[model samples]
Target: MKNKRKILDWMLLIAWMILIFTMSNQPANISDSQSEGAIKVLLLIGIDANSIFGQLANFIVRKCAHFLEYMVLALLYINVAKHYFTKKVVIISTVAFVFTYACSDEIHQLFVQGREGAFRDVLIDTCGGVTLLLIRLGISSIKLLKLR
Candidate 1:
């Protein structure tokens, strides 16, 4: 079971790194006459929902995306720490490490051609990491309860 978890953890880490790299390197698509693409499709749908919901949908999407990003980062963090430490220590350290990465990721965006760092995004990203940790805790608690 331990080895399986470790292997799964590494796989998830690789996937997360790929996602982060892809998202970070994504160029701004700025062409006046350009037609539709997948991002455009999502934007159109999101903007339409935003119009109807008055920012709620947009806020939800942004939060969810941030949360997903951080959850992956947290998993990667936990994976690294588990090899060298206790679960509690691993969780705490991973959260701290991921929070720093979130800050750096935002700051790095400031140098991108059309990107600017926002403190709110950083907070959202951290919240995502925390949220994932809580979920893991919740699952563990539930399992303990079942065992008892």
Candidate 2:
């Protein structure tokens, strides 16, 4: 049963990695269109979607996608690492893995037509990952205090 759970955790991590790669493989135009549609939804809810605001909204949506994707990836990495390491080591290793993968993901984007790798995106991704890890640790610490 323990082995099965460990396998499942690793499988989930790999699945998320594939999903991120698949998204990065999309053409720039296609990705932009998806973000535009999301922005339109925001407009429907009265977001003042004027020309400038519309563009800004689109930009925010795109960056948030990067943030959210890596956030989930980091969470999954933590789960997978817990199977093999102490809690402290899991936290450190998960952050390192997420950061390395974020860099690689940007590099992968460089090969996609109409997409160029940006260090800014990598920083954004890493921030997302680390933020999630910190939040998780905070919650765990709170729970431990409650148990005392």
Candidate 3:
């Protein structure tokens, strides 16, 4: 049963990685429309998505999506890592792999038509993973304090 749980964990991680790859492989226009569609939904909520703000909204939504993708990726990764390593090892490995994957994902984008890789995006992605790391650390610290 424990072995099965580990397999399930890896399957989920692989599936999410595949999803991110597929999204990144989309053509530029399709990707833009995706973020724009999100803005449209926000527009329905009566938010000011005027022409100028629309541009800003698009940028924010796009960057947030990148942040959120790797954030969830890090969360899944740490879960699997905990099963195979010590606390310190898991923390180190989680950040290392998440950052590495983020770098590779951007490189992958460079090959995709209409997609250009940017270092800034990689930083944004790393920040997302770090956000999860920080949150998890805080929770662990609280737990330790309570136990003491």
Tell me, by lDDT, which candidate is best. Answer: 3
For model 1, residues 67-141, the per-residue Cα lDDT tens digits are 787887987878767887998798888778778877887787677667667888888888888888898899999
| Candidate 1: stretches off by over 4 Å | 1-8, 30-48, 55-60
RMSD of each: 4.4, 1.8, 1.7
lDDT of 2 by residue, 34-78 (tens): 888877787788775545564577778899899999999999998
Which regions of candidate 3 deviate over 4 angstroms? 45-54
Question: Ten-residue segment with the worst summed lDDT in candidate 3?
Answer: 46-55
Score candidate 2 by TM-score against the native: 0.92
Ranking by lDDT: 3, 2, 1
| lDDT for 146 (candidate 3) | 100
How well does each candidate superpose onto the true structure, as a TM-score?
0.73, 0.92, 0.92
Error in Å for residue 15 of model 1: 4.1
Candidate 1 clashing pairs, residues 3+ apart or interchain:
none
lDDT of 3 by residue, 1-148 (tens): 9999899889999999999999999989999999989888877887656564745888888998999999999999987998999989988898898889989999999999999999999899999999999999999899999999
